[model samples]
Target: MNFPLILFILLVITGSIWLLDIIFWKKKREPNENEPWWIEYPKSFFPIILIVFSLRSFVIEPFKIPSGSMIPTLLVGDFILVNKYVYGIRLPVINKKIYDMDKPKRGDVLVFRFPEDSSIDYIKRIVGLPGDVITYHDKQLIINGEVIRMEYEGDYKYIESGLGYIYSDRYSEYLNDESHSIIINQDIRGVQFSNVRQFQFRDNCKYRRTGFTCEVPAGNYFTLGDNRDSSSDSRYWGFVPEENIVGKAFMIWWNFGDLGRIGLSIK
Candidate 1:
């Protein structure tokens, strides 16, 4: 469902000009009077274009956090802004890179096309870099032969607009050397990690619960979810090709019922 911003802008421009021609310009009523300089123009296209440019280039773009796969960190209905330029500027839609930027780092929240289905966009945290072995066993993340450290922080209250509440474990884990808290539903464990026969880019992945060792393939990355046990990530689907990346998600700009959702970083 991702559309190129260029198409959106073109649509807006065409519609605006055509509408103005019908309402005010057609009759030529004002002529020089116009509707008072600024008022006479659409005045709408500017904001739209700004949003498209910022979202398509140097800043963040809005996205609806879809599934509970990212439960504790992101929730359904949470509309977040993904950092576009952090990983470079690729024109929207076709996703052709015209500008080069930094690559994704560990502990970063990312948005990318599902390796299994490029048409579907999925978000997860980067767990393994190219050539790093990643293993997850007994719910612990093992990367490059080292287990990621996690500290228990009791429980967190789950909040969804109208849904009352539920308590979940609050644990802080360090990845890419960055520390962050995540919520987990213990009742959801016991599911085994499955491996892919072969992936589009990389060939195969090893499976374990204490974590597995996966040398991230060239131009491919290993990703997981902050809500560990819940994500359908590289652990299940396979590695993410560099070309599949949409962008890096950094902020939550707005939430319908709660403005407090704004200004939080994704990691």
Candidate 2:
């Protein structure tokens, strides 16, 4: 559901009624009697709706991690706060940027609306920027013909609630100056690149048996989940347009399952 759109509608309704009552209906009602239900309710809710709408629309917004695609960095059930204005100021509902700000850097975790289905939101790490060539082979990431530094960490284990434990090799990948951990399961093989859906800029990418190589188009970005082996990301889909960006996820505010995860900074 589009919560922002709903909030915006409520804000408009309440704000209008409150304003109309102040300008025209305030003196029409007797001071002794209760105000009309419509005006009273709207007046009561107008300030609240306006405040919430302003904050969520232009400042920060909260989101929950529903999948383990981010694994060690962001676990399932982690409630995160995304900085909306860090990238740019965009209008709510119809997200159109009206201000310019910093572009996404490599290794930054980003929240974006899925290109194929804008209603669906996805979170992933920025791996490739526009005009860069990204290649993945033998579970290693190569950008612009240079192999990105990857230092083996250790075995990473994930516990599924109903299922048993899953294990993968963990590595700290260095992109630009920032570093983040990623997990790749050798037992889990990737699908043939031919099986991927035809997405925008498909012609720019070349897929093979081992991995794929792509030149990120202008104003677009290539993203991947930290859980490399299990994620269905830009490698399977396509580059995310700048306009699809929601915000940069900064911190984990809550995790019901693991209290220790609360207030952890998201890299």
Candidate 3:
């Protein structure tokens, strides 16, 4: 559902009703007469709705994690808060940027509208920036001819919704200045070229049996899920256009299954 659009609609309806009554309907009523329930309800709600709409549109917004793609960094039930203005202040619903701000950096966790389907939102870590050449082979990431550092952590185990328990190798990946953990299942190979669609800038990427290499197009970013082998990310689709960006996810405010995760800052 397009939540911001719905909230904007409600805000307009309530504000219009409240304004119309003040200009035309107020004096028509008898002096000292009580307001009708219909008028009273909308008038009372307009200010509150306006405040909520403003905050959600230009300041911050909340989103829930629906998949295990982010794994150790974010869980299935994690409710995260995204900083809306950190990247730029875009108009709500239309999402057209009216201000300029910092561009997304490598290793930053970003939430963006899926390039293939704008209505669907996806979250992934930025692995490649504009003009950077990214290569992934043998479960290692290389950017601009430099191999990103990776150190083996240990064996990691987790439970899948219906697959019971699964084990994988965990490693700490140092991408530029950001250090984060990732998991890889050696039994599964990387995405196959045949399974990928002819997305925009498809020619810029070359896929092989082991891995793939791509040069990020201008104003676009390459991303990947923390759960390496389990994620369906840029390797399978395409780059994330700058306009499709929503915001940088910064914190986990709630997690029904794990209260300990509340208030934890996102890496």
Candidate 4:
């Protein structure tokens, strides 16, 4: 559901009624009789809705991780806080940026509207920036003809609810001077290209059995999940436009599944 849109509507309705009461009905009501239900409820909720709306729209917003695509960095059920104004001030609901701010750096975890479906929000790490040439082949990342450095971190064990356990090779990848861990299943063959979606700048990408190469367009970014082999990211869809960005996720405020993850900083 579109929670922000719904909140905005509520804010407007409640705020309007509150204002009308102040201007037309505040002193007219008799002390013995109760105020009209509509005025009473709206007046009671207006301040609260205003405060929540302001905070969520301009300061920070909370989100829950629904998948393990981020694995070690962000687990399923992790509740994260995204810094809204760090990217720029944007209008609520429509999410149009009205101020300039820092651009996303490589290795930053970001939440953005899915290009194919704006209603769906997706989170991933920034891997390639505008004008960058990115390639992934045989589980290795190549940017602008230079292979990114990776340090083997041994094997990562993943526990699935239905499946017993899964093991994948874990490596600490260095990109743009930042380091982050990623898991890749060597047993999985090259990325599948059959279900590739046609996206903006689709012609800039070349897919093959080994992997894919993409030349990120201006004002667009290439993203990938830390769970390399299992993620449906830029390799399958396409580059993310700057305008679709929601915010940079910075902290894990809560994780019902893993209490230790609470208060952890997101890289």
Candidate 5:
């Protein structure tokens, strides 16, 4: 629950105590007197906690993948590191950018707060930027009237925790300058309109028997999961707002079940 906020609270508490001891408490105590437990503990922890909080808030942060939504790129047990300052340095807890930096690029894997539920975080690959027209018809991705290149890789299969083995067709999809693997379940025929929710800019999207098309609104992004049919992403919910962005995921630092994944760069 709200790790950043909790860290911030601890930072304030410890920092205040450390400063108070330095300015008032320490000076008032006799030179040879030992410090009280409260002062000693907080003073000792303040520096260490400050270093951790600073690194986590503005440098890089660790996250563990918990779902199959980003299956091919990030597994359920994968522990990834998100670069916090790549898109810009945002304030801790509030998540408001105070400095400007590079904008999010298409094909970049990103972590962001779910629009419908701010408390929850989700990861997906960026497909469309602001002002882009994204269309998904018959499992093909079209952006701005041009079809994105998708080269067939081969058949792919994976085990879902409670569902046993699932199979799909895998392809290397090229978006912008990057190419990443994506899976499509041929069994799922078309976009199910019933699953698309009436989100804020629902009027901008049109659903059909084949699929759907949407013009990405200003300051928002369209994303899709690598595991196409298994994901509940922008197609079913809505675009990710600029403010909801967390950071760009860059590497997999740990994977208990698959040690080979450690130190692998995230595509």
Candidate 6:
């Protein structure tokens, strides 16, 4: 979550409630016409409760898909909700896990803090799990020393998704530990196999051109995007630490220009 937006919302809600109480609900016996210290005190908690419920229940929470990284799966303006407790219930802001829910599967779309900058949130798929060796050479996924069968029909065309764009290809991978549909575009190159250098976990990753290999750290996991070629993810920013995980995105609640986009599960 963005700090500025969180702080601004907190201020707005707290300030609104406090102002209302002062002007309309002030105790008649109060001696001071000037603001009372006690009223301001409780006003502070309005934002606190809001922040708590939002962070705790929702986990990763809802964020505008800012870029096309998860395109075809998530759009730029698609308002999607992430269930914070899907993977596990974690405290908001600090992001401490309290209870276990489920482990990340190969095909689930997820949101996590950027390993490079924990302040920034990035979305990607669980292409590789802890102890899994993943290779993406020539646009094919190799896991644990075997190619995970990808059929290529040559170039795929994609429409623009929000602030970013989407390329389409028919891909099928695993979810819930089973094979499913995934999208990839051969054009997505550049940062696909390279891990970001300037952050934690540099010792855990290795690089190559035919493909790169990284050992998913014990407490960390690797992620990719269903919309390949368009996402800046763990492949570039490094692995998502256990603490940096937000939640699992389940559905598209709303989308602009495409009313039909509502209620689509991530594939």
Best by lDDT: 5
lDDT of 3: 0.92
Q: Which stretches of candidate 6 lie over 4 Å from their true place?
A: 1-60, 152-155, 160-168, 175-180, 187-198
Task: List the pairs of residues colliding in candidate 4.
Answer: none
Clashes of each: 15, 0, 0, 0, 0, 7
Off by over 4 Å in 3: none
User: How do the residues 51-121 of candidate 4 rate in per-residue lDDT, one tens digit apiece?
Assistant: 99999989999999988889878888899999999989999999999998888898889999999899999
Tens digit of per-residue lDDT, candidate 5, span 202-232: 9989988999999999999999999998898
lDDT of each: 0.73, 0.91, 0.92, 0.90, 0.93, 0.70
lDDT of 1 by residue, 145-248 (tens): 79889999998776545577756788999976778887776765623444344565444555445445567888888887776655677766778888888888
Instruction: Give the range of the ten consecutive residues with the poorest summed lDDT in model 5.
Output: 189-198
Give stretches of model 4 more than 4 Å off: 31-33
* Candidate 2 lDDT, 161-194, residue by residue in tens: 6598998999999998778889989886554455
TM-score against truth, every candidate: 0.76, 0.97, 0.97, 0.96, 0.98, 0.75
Residue 60's lDDT in candidate 3: 90
What's the CA error at residue 191 for candidate 3, in Å? 2.1
Among these predictions, the greatest TM-score belongs to: 5
Clashing pairs in 3: none
Query: How much is 118 displaced in model 4, in angstroms?
Result: 0.8
Looking at model 5, the pairs that clash are none
Which 10 successive residues of model 1 have the least lDDT summed?
Answer: 189-198
Worst ten in a row by lDDT for model 4: 157-166
Model 3 TM-score, all chains together: 0.97
Q: How far off is model 5, as Cα RMSD?
A: 0.9
